[model samples]
Target: MKTRKKILVACGTAIATSTVVARKIEEELEKRGIAVETTQCKASEVPSKAEGHDLIVATTFVSGAGDIPVIQTVSFLTGVGIEADIDRIISYIEGA
Candidate 1:
């Protein structure tokens, strides 16, 4: 079986906005049959919380994420360039 990709979806509060973005990412990845485990957390927690994550998708800037690929985007909520963002996520999954 293929291993699932671990994703970190972070925002300010890790509630409302992150929830929406995480759901969208889950749906998109599910459609592509790319299994993923998403963890929601505050952007501020990303540095420590992103230890084993394959990717970091955040609604705000997140520094100190080490070598993790951080995609700072709000398009999932704004409905703008969302596909591009998803494509980026897919690329990472594909590369992995």
Candidate 2:
């Protein structure tokens, strides 16, 4: 069987909108049968929190932190960049 992919979702704050974005990512990933682990954290904490994760996703800009692949995107609520962002994440995880 294929291994499940682990993902980290982080934001500038660990409340409200960040939580919502994390949930949306979890839901979307789960629908595809991909295993995801999400955490809402301050943007500054993302690099540290991303340890052992296959991918790190941030709602805001973050740099020079985790060694894993990272995706920087806006909230999914905007519905503008979500699909492309998600596709990039999945492709990265799938080693595409």
Candidate 3:
């Protein structure tokens, strides 16, 4: 069986918008039968929290440090460009 991909979703703040983004990604990935684990975190913790995850998704541009693949997108909450961006991220993870 294939292992589920773990993802870290982060923004400047964790409460307000990052939670929404994380939920959306979870829902979308589930619909495609891709099991994913999402953790909402502050942007500053992304580098540390991303360990062991398949991807790190940030709502804003992240600078410095992280070995895993990263997807920079703010649309996960706004619902704009979310589908396409998420699709690309998923494809990259799967293809890799």
Candidate maximizing TM-score:
1
lDDT of each: 0.90, 0.75, 0.79
lDDT of 1 by residue, 1-96 (tens): 978899999999998999999999999888977779899999889888989999999999888899889899999999999889989998987786
Report the C-alpha lDDT of model 3 over 23-81, residue by residue, as the tens digit. 88888888888878788888888767777777788888775435777888878777789
Write one digit per residue (lDDT tens) for candidate 2, span 1-96: 776677777677767667888888878877878766676777788766777777777778876554788777774868787778777878988882
- Residue 13, model 1: Cα distance from true site in angstroms: 0.7
Q: What is the model-wide C-alpha lDDT for candidate 3?
A: 0.79
As a TM-score, model 3 comes out at 0.87
Provide TM-scores for the models. Answer: 0.95, 0.81, 0.87
For each candidate, how many residue pairs have backbone atoms clashing (under 3 Å)? 0, 0, 0
Candidate 2: segments with Cα more than 4 A from true spot: none
Of 2 and 3, which scores higher on TM-score? 3
- After superposition on all CA atoms, what RMSD does each candidate show versus the true structure? 0.9, 2.0, 1.5
Q: Any residue pairs clashing in model 2, and if so which?
A: none
Give the runs in model 3 whose Cα sits over 4 Å from its true position: none
Worst 10 residues of 2 by lDDT: 58-67
